[model samples]
Target: MSDIRDEMLRTLDRIVEANLTIAEREKADGNGPSAKLWAALTEQGMTALGETDSEIPFADAMALVARSGYHAVPVPLAETIMARRLLSRADIALPEGSITLAARAGGQANLVGVAYGGTAAHVVVADGDSLHLLQVTNAVVHNAYNQAGEPRDTIDLGKAKTIDRKPLAHATDVLIAEGALLRSVQLAGALSRTLEHCLTWVNDRVQFGKPIARFQAIQHAMAIMASEAAAARAAADMAVEASEKQADWFAVAVAKSRAGEAAGKTAAAAHAAFGAMGFTREHPLHYSTRRLWAWRDDFGSEVIWQSKIGQHMAAKGGENLWATLTEMN
Candidate 1:
């Protein structure tokens, strides 16, 4: 099974690299994923990994999303897979094109910062206890973009009518957990790529007739960046493993918190190493770093998840804390 997953991920990486180059990503930047890229992903059967019959296990599906992040592919395939699975479970006919998830509490009809909201054809919104499928075109979309130039639009559900509806208990919590896990895996992938860019920059840039990589301080910072990247990826892998079982909020909370923290550290280190070069739009480094910054805050920020972890530990008390924490999900 692991062999199959590795083969699939390698194949996915190839497809993404071949089809969505930095130039292509830029062509569709601030708008959404280009049609050509989406076509390539769909033709490769990369969109239905989470569906039971797709042969790709749910945990493996998470890995695919992480791989997409590595290439900085500007698409919401994570939401598309999860949304289709939810609709499938509800016996709702799946719609074509991309679908984004928007989970919110209470009866808030307006969803702020809906990832891929501007481009996706449909949105599966978990509004408190009920799930709603609405046409993105029907909604009043206030155009917006994240720091990475990915479409992060404000969707007004007030004007839109639900195409399908179903009762889903604890829908908000379920969707939030899903969002956090997906973002964490993505963060992990982006962190690794960011580290790679930093390493390459440090090795190539000359300082005082010597590569910056020769400097002890530079090497130390690079080492820390690598460690954070490794830890973030490990946390993401653990979260995916947890999905094979209960996939509770606790598992995703840990992953999101860790990965988000890693993103901050990794991005800062990359920018510091690259100096003014990293901050420029002409540099490829910003592609991954900006997404890392935006995604870490999307589902839930590291601060929010860290506080949740603390609160959960406090409730368990000191005696059972280690056992409970270790055993979570």
Candidate 2:
């Protein structure tokens, strides 16, 4: 496992370097960079990493994506991985670089203004008690906006073809859990990078005859950011482990909820530390902070996850709540 993790870290370093270059170019050109990065990832077999039936390992895969978040790479890791996993379950072969997936809200099939719909080849619709897979061949994809100035859209899937089959046992739940965990991991990475960037900036951009990082207030804020990043990473790891083991859904919910809160708070703290510079479009900190905010609201927000966790615990009764957690671990 350690060997695999090390290999993934090395791969992630290469990916991050390349992605940073591409992201800079894309930002200059004013185009969405996710598609190009997705093509690169597909070449590297990223989409297939955790989708196989042979007890596929996910730790390395998760680590790679988390690092991608650190660099604010625009690739759709959650969407692509979820699509691959779902298609694999349904015995569908997803062509590399040709398939895209995204999560939509509101339990309605024809709703618009969801996340990352413009470049998607397919959309995963999670309605009540059922999951619908719709191909976006003829769908109208509007060039909607997200925080990073990335291309999002309101997909019109009314005329699109659909699959009526029921998903694999607990498939929707697992996908949601796994997607949230992945997003959380990415948020942790972004938060860590932002905090590091702020600290480095303060150290070099001296004020008052000394580095701003020397100030007690800045030090405290940095400490909080570091602690929150660690907590988010730990929670995300727990979610990933639970997903790998096919543990109870409550574990995933708890992990995701904690991670979401951490991501939101940590990003805000980092931005505050960086002051107005972080808000400028010319600065790179906004890139990470914007994505952090957007991703936190994706794949079941903190409030939603907390409600789900509470409901699960209540359903299990007070006596069985602790038992459920233990069993999941």
Candidate 3:
């Protein structure tokens, strides 16, 4: 099983590296989700990983998602997978194209900062113990973009009609947990890519007849970036493992908080190492770094998750703190 998973991830990495070009990133800047990308992902069975008969593990699915982030692939791939999985849990038939999840309020749902919301065919909202499916056609959408230039729409369900409504198998907070986990995985991938780019640039760029990478100051900066990236990867790995074992909120919280903290530091270090070139639109480094900035705040920020962890610890008291920290997925 591990062999199969590794093979799949390697394949995905190649596919993303080959297809996710500068042109594709520019195309996605103001556009909705790409049909071509969706077709390719669906053909690879990447979109149906969470379906009942898909046979793909949750951890493997997240690994693919993280790879997508590494290449800075412009799509709502993560949201679509998460929406499909949640819909299945609620016994709702999954729709074609992109799908996103949201929370409903008072016969209406105002889903803010929804990735790929503008292009999604349907929206799944959990209201109390019921899950409601709403068509995108009926909703008023205010299209927006995040720091990464990815679509982050505000969907107004004030006048929308429900396509379907059914009893929910789990709480809506489950979506938040899963969303945070996904973002953490993506942040890790992007940070890794950012570090890679910085390393390459530093090694190639020379000053005073020597490579910048040879300088102690530059090497120190790269080391810090690498450390943050490593920490993020560890957090993402733990989160995915925990999710696969069963939804462990504590592990999820720790993963997001840790990864979120790493994301900011990694971005800052990458920029510092790369210098002015990293900030330019012509440079591809911004694609990874900007996404890192936007994603850290999505689902839940570091502050939010840190508070949750602190509250949980306080409730558990001091003696059990070590056990809680040492507990494995």
Best by TM-score: 1
Considering lDDT, where higher is better, how would the candidates rank from best to worst?
1, 3, 2
lDDT of 1 by residue, 77-141 (tens): 88898787666655567887788888877567688899888778899888777778898686756
In candidate 1 the C-alpha lDDT for residue 183 amounts to: 92
Cα lDDT tens digits for candidate 2, 99-166:
44444444555646444565666666555445567676677556666666655666676776674445
Off by over 4 Å in 2: 22-31, 54-56, 102-107, 111-114, 127-132, 162-166, 245-248, 315-320
* lDDT to native, each model: 0.83, 0.68, 0.80
**Candidate 1 local accuracy as lDDT?**
0.83
TM-score of each: 0.94, 0.86, 0.93
Candidate 2 overall Cα lDDT vs. reference?
Answer: 0.68
User: What C-alpha lDDT, on a 0 to 100 scale, does residue 138 get in candidate 1?
Assistant: 64
Candidate 1 collision pairs:
none
Winner by TM-score between candidate 2 and candidate 1: 1
- For model 2, name the residue pairs that clash: none
